[model samples]
Target: MQKNALKNIIYSIVLLLLVFLVYLYRKDQPITSDNPDSDVFKMVVSGQTMGTSYRIVYLDPSGRDFKQQIDSLLEVFNQSLSTYIPDSEISRFNKGDSLVYESKFFFPILAKSKEVYTNTDGAFDPTVGPLVNVWGFGPGGASLEDSVSIPDLLRQVGLEKVEFDSVQVRKNTPGIYLDFSAIAKGYGVDVVGRFLESKEIEHFLVEIGGELMAKGSNENGELWRVGISKPDEEGAANELFGIIALNAKGLATSGNYRNFYIVDGKKYSHTISPFTGYPVVHGLLGATVVADDCMTADAYATAMMVMGTEKSIALQKEVEGLEIFLIFSDENGMIKSYVSEGLKPYLSYAEQNKPSLDQ
Candidate 1:
């Protein structure tokens, strides 16, 4: 995969248009001002991590600088879970390490992966690593298009085949590998979010690639506004899916539109189905999921894309703390949209009253 391919695959779901929000903050435009004190100044930070870029904006009421701390924390996080890092814990495990000790950063995502795996009926799986590799999405570019039978790799791929205690993780099948790429970015956002809160920073926006979490309000004291870019367009300005308020909530979007390939006139998406061991071929173009935390939102967004619009909306009714909006092409390949009741209020605001961005 190309360096930008992974970023595109993850971000195809949502784009946190911080550029618009940053404009509002920099101009000191009368946006939303929930804060009474004008002593706060905004610190905008950007850096590279996990093969993608990250941007953080926060109200720096105190004079403390957290750039170094943020860097160090992400470094540790990469060492623990990054698949590109050869000696990283995840890479080591994939290379058949039996007793690799877990990191504080690793356990939570691993545990959460299991939770999402079960909840989505295995739609969101970490153990699909082998399947991912066989689909040519992994490090080595390999594809198993010749055989109609499910490849041997799928036999080794299942969350049930992996076991973990507080101490360590063990794979029942040696080939069983854990891939947190789908979830770790959101976890990273939460890690930074926690650090910001620890330092008494109340309002901030943290986004890695496109996965994001926002707390409190922008400088205008109103809720943080974010736009979800339309999935079907390429380079014609941002025809947004919708603009919505994000306050103290994590939002994640996942889609197959930008991260798919064509073979024999059939488009194969990066979203591999855990059950069929093939890239998802569906009408569900994209899904943007909102949850109390970014990790949960991230997993569900990917799952919803796999589940398609109907199943995702059905799942939303049963799952609490989730707000979803799905975009799909109908029978005639015409654009149609769905917004769960949970998400309607956030996108209901008018253009002028929107917390960020003029259009």
Candidate 2:
């Protein structure tokens, strides 16, 4: 009887050891869905890039975490495009290095900027950097006295003065500077989305700052939903004006409500118009655009803020596959919105506070 009890104790020890080993193995494995119908696993990777945060959610059958690779890719992108980086390709070009032939990133954005500049009639100009600086919005602090130089700065604020092709970029005017802040974040979103696609990730959403690109359905097999924030002051409570479902598309929002300064009871917006060389004063408080790509969406959103409500509506009608949702003040000072027909099908709002559609 004693011998029999000893053998049973030994067997119990071996079984417990096997159970512990299995537990450790499963603990190291990637998280998978509990649902038996779905074989793919969901993974999220987030990090900082381009002076902002980025989040990527992807459904991978292989359950691979791509944080390291994504961070490395963003570093390479910054080396090519980030103006804040002292020795970046764009910074070097802005400092009068006329030939940036090695950068594959700069040319495409320059080409896109030129296209948008032409289409917006120069409303979306990357060459407005000097004006931004003098207005206290850029690296240079507020020099209200330097406002006298607005006309001279305007001379340097046209994309037509800059020339570039697939190989190299050259500036016709030495003072002409390019600041892609308006569109770079959206391009970063596109870059990550393309990277995921290259890795055979069919279902993913990539967001940089507030701009985003969505492809396929989310892990729950539903279209990705994005929220638009209400046009409120900087310190106000976070609130959503509406939400929209997106698939295989990009969305971007631009608003002057948060980034502005008040001096002597007069408000100054961060959005300096390329035409007037001053902050735009308009009823349009926010502009959200949906387009085939995030870069186009971002640039057009900024342009719409400068164009105001009517011109933005007109432009949206002219451009195919372009949709806009604009928040503005009506003639009676009441808050209102204008939603394009294509965008309306995807957007939803609270019934109690539904914005009167200007349509």
Candidate 3:
């Protein structure tokens, strides 16, 4: 009787352990992992815990170990990049205190910001935080209808007021704020790609927010296909004027079609021009840039928007490596598009009313 009782107890314990293992397996069973022979594994990490959905599709079969490493990589990125969390490095810097000295990731981004500032003649300034806040785009908040004095907004729009030595970052002006809206998403994508590469992920695509970075080819030996969003409301994938085969490169787009509010029937772009301290009502509707780095693509898109179509296309021609597509709205409300010669092979113009060179 004693022996039978002991056997029963052991069997119950084993049963519970089995159930727990099954639950975990069910929870984490890879979405498209069965493609061991197949090239791509598409996994969607919910954006609820993190700020946004981090969609990663890796080509190689490093398997469970690769997934574990990806989880750790995400943890580090969230700690360093999340602007909402006060403890994040960016938030800590924003909190105002003893200089939260530069980390390996933060300083490089800040340093590179100066290049975009110089290129756009302060049009893409990261220091436009004061304006963004006045508009209520920051965590402290802003209002689209609030009576915003143009001069008041202009006072806080330059990079000259930001003081960053190797050890500290200080605001030279009181109302001055630093919001990295133009480039942070691209930087985040870069961080994820670098982390995956370190873990022997030779092939993958990491997208944060709307920015994307692709590395290597899938198991089928094809570069990743990424669809550029259309500014037109009626367009579908077939109407997609731009598609790129990405291999270890990043792509980004900036547009006025989304994330904007109309006040007094005047349409405003969320992509503000720092020099004017106002949302651009430029004829250009959207600009997409493809480059070796997400940060560069992100920054360049903002620069191009401020430059407008004419100047942007001219600049693209001069820059030997930049590949860009510019879409514009004419005085008549018709859509017009242009692409750099280098991007010609990958691009397809969806609209019949293409912008003319005479304009």
Candidate 4:
């Protein structure tokens, strides 16, 4: 009888071990559906970075939380690109330290800035930092209208004043400053999106400030939808001018409607013209651009804001795979918009406001 009991105990131990192994296997396995038996889930992570809030939504089959990893990635990006950090790589470059070869983040953005600068004929120049400061839109909030000369500032406002390659960047002019504020947010979105893709996450949306990138379908298995805000004053009620369905694309918008100042009955927009060294005064209130990447969309949106409506429309025709939606005022102060042929199928106007559409 004692021998029989010993054999039974051994059999129980082996069964328990087998059960534990099965549990471990199931825990590591990924489920691809939202059914009760499946583990696939939608995860949302949000935080503040680059002086603005960011939100990331992704469908994870493993049901893992990635908030901590996402935060770390954004912190590293800011250390390389954020001017507000004062000791960041870009800040150091602005403060006369020209050689920044250590950062993995700096070179890619620098290269993109050069491309846009050349393509836009200096309209998308990052070397316009001095003009941005004097216009009270930069970190230096005080407008130096009384002490600074526009012509003197214009000398320091061109990408040709800076030279850079993949390894190192050198400033040709001592006073030249590089500010990637216009494109950095979009690049931030791209950075987070790439991180998700690296982890084998197929469906995701990454948004920083107003710039965003979308890939694959959303939680409901439909194309991701985004809204463009109406061009209104800073204190006015926030509303959407239109909605767009984005499919593996990036979208960014630039407008002076919210961030402008009136001095002596003249409105000064925050978007400074690189060539003129002055805030652009034009009827174009907003420019929205969509591209394959958020960084390209962001830079082109800013360039379009400076280029005005007609020039921007012409540019859209010249560049392939670029879709633009331009909002401007007519001679009688009526709001009118021009939507590129590619964007018309994906765009729809809001109920209360429908401006005359021009293709």
Candidate 5:
């Protein structure tokens, strides 16, 4: 398959997104706070490992009612989207017909994913489960390296090779499966965002894993600022490669940081290419995308990773309203970066102050 064709396939399978809440620490000296809807202070119920934290800060005259509502919202979101629960819609679908059939819940996201797949020319595949498992990244423990042969693996993988009817989805070849891990978190974020909005949360921030969506503003009226990870080093973040005013927008980042392996003397990325049946070896270390929906941003970031730096730039030009930030290594081994033009609208003051490598 051509590079573009391969990317489109992986793009479809790479839709799963994961979120963790991490930790929340309030100011040592209670920062001046304001009251809006209800005076409900921020509280984190779980750890980041729980994946994605949904917080609601409201002006609640009666703290009891607000707390109850927040808890109810969180429960609803978990019930609907949690893969950890075997009874959840996603979990059931993933374990049942999703193996060789399509369920009702799968169609909604599948339909939405079609546009992203077509636009990226198959760079983003949501049906890359089989490959993910063979590479030892699936739900099961890592597969023996020798058990998977790359050439043989390629024959069984391909987005086009998978057939999906309205009622069922099946692979052309046996043993191929689907995994939406890449886009799941994004979907989860959207779910939580909607739930909060239903509670009349006009302004708030929601983050799952690294996927996030921010809107409205703190009572003080400052836009929510987010920091993007610097892929050069683990646990490093740049002040602000971009910022969304929470004028109501979302951000999702896909990178080769958390999951990867070293083979021989080279490092292999976890974002595997369905076309080659091999982990992406490109110098493009990470890509962050901003869009109205966190799911789209999440999947698109992975697609861009396979597109690499050059193709990603060209593709960005063709797609409007899509912003991308790529961290890549040049020939000399130095890490370099690029940002799509659309991203300029969200550039934070600090990002603007930083030297523009593109120029």
Candidate 6:
């Protein structure tokens, strides 16, 4: 009887110890990894890319050095996308290679380009390269001449002239060159953003040239803030039109004021109309677009420039996931502005219309 009692007591003791261990395990569960407050340290990385500069800020408590890896990755990225490089996939394709080929980066950019191309009604044609060259903005472009043939170039500038699938890319017509410059910088920003993410860095801001992609929060544990430049030609440097609180968003700006020429009392912008076969001449001074991805934002920004003020505004109203701000001149050349309803919360101030160009 005593032996039986001792066995029962031992079993009970073992059961209690097991219960205590499980309780201890439950108490030791970790906090959520998605918490934004834990990543306070930031590592900044910058380099030249796509004929422009790139900047990346990411969180890393390990102090890991990714500069070499980043440089190498960007170098290969340039090789795949840069038209300036004669041997690049894009360059070779432009030179008349018919194969789509496999690439981690080129295909995604091309797919996004096609998506924007379709949605924008050819307003964002990458095949406008031939026209871009004629306007003195692209490789082998000449100085603006009084007389230049445009109708001939229009024949080659349609996005429909090119076709691509997962395994193949073919141009329906000869001389249909593709130029992704409008969206490539934004894609570069995304590339860097993905690189940071792959390294398990959760909080990051990536900017290449003027395009940007932001994820999570900053060191302040607040949303990442990005500034849009005022369209003021006479204002001080770094003057902001307004600040945008960016969280898991991509931003891009397309402006005629930045890359245009005044010749013989006529202004010629780099943005060309595929339908008109000429540089866009419209009331739009600039367009800022926010999208789910930087590539879409960049392409839409350029497309909106081609669509002009009214069309773009209409587009903003109908699009489900786009936010935009437009700075344009009215019929009297008076400066005005339009802001999407979704973008109002992001603006730092009231963002009323510009006083006047004279101001």
Candidate No. with top TM-score: 2
Candidate 2: worst-modelled 10 consecutive residues by lDDT = 16-25
Q: After superposition, which runs of candidate 3 have C-alpha atoms over 4 Å from their true positions?
A: 1-50, 65-72, 144-147, 233-239, 349-359
- How much is the lDDT of residue 340 in candidate 2? 94
Residue-level lDDT of model 2, residues 73-115, one tens digit each, is 9999999888778888888888884864665678878888898
Q: List the residue pairs that clash in candidate 2.
A: none
Better of 3 and 5 by lDDT: 3
**Residue 308 error, candidate 5, Å:** 0.5
lDDT of 5 by residue, 263-341 (tens): 4555556688866777887777778788888888878887888778888888878876677777678888876778776
Instruction: Give stretches of model 6 more than 4 Å off.
Output: 1-39, 143-147, 350-359
Q: What would you estimate as the lDDT of candidate 5?
A: 0.60
Q: lDDT by residue for model 3 over 129-161, one digit each (tens)?
A: 767655544554435444768777788678787
RMSD for each of the candidates: 4.6, 15.5, 13.6, 17.0, 6.9, 20.2
- The whole-model lDDT of each prediction reads 0.75, 0.78, 0.63, 0.78, 0.60, 0.73
Candidate 1: the clashing residue pairs are: 13-253, 13-254, 32-220, 32-221, 33-220, 33-221, 34-221
Candidate 6 residue-wise lDDT, 1-359, digit = tens: 23333333333222111101000111112222356565344567767777666667766766566778888988998888888899888888998848567467877888898888888888998999888877666755444455767887788878777788777689899988888889998888788788889989888777777788889876556788776666654443255566677869998888766555545566567788887978888888878899988888999999999999999989888777899988788899876777788887776632453333212
Model 3 deviation from native, Cα RMSD in Å: 13.6
Task: Report the C-alpha displacement of residue 310, candidate 3, in angstroms.
Answer: 1.4
Ranking by lDDT: 4, 2, 1, 6, 3, 5
lDDT of 3: 0.63
Q: Tell me how far candidate 5 lies from the true structure as C-alpha RMSD in angstroms.
A: 6.9
TM-score of each: 0.87, 0.88, 0.79, 0.87, 0.76, 0.84
Scored by lDDT, model 4 comes in at 0.78
Count of clashing residue pairs in every prediction? 7, 0, 2, 0, 45, 1
Instruction: Give the Cα error of residue 98 in candidate 2, in Å.
Output: 0.7
TM-score, predicted candidate 2 vs. hidden true structure: 0.88
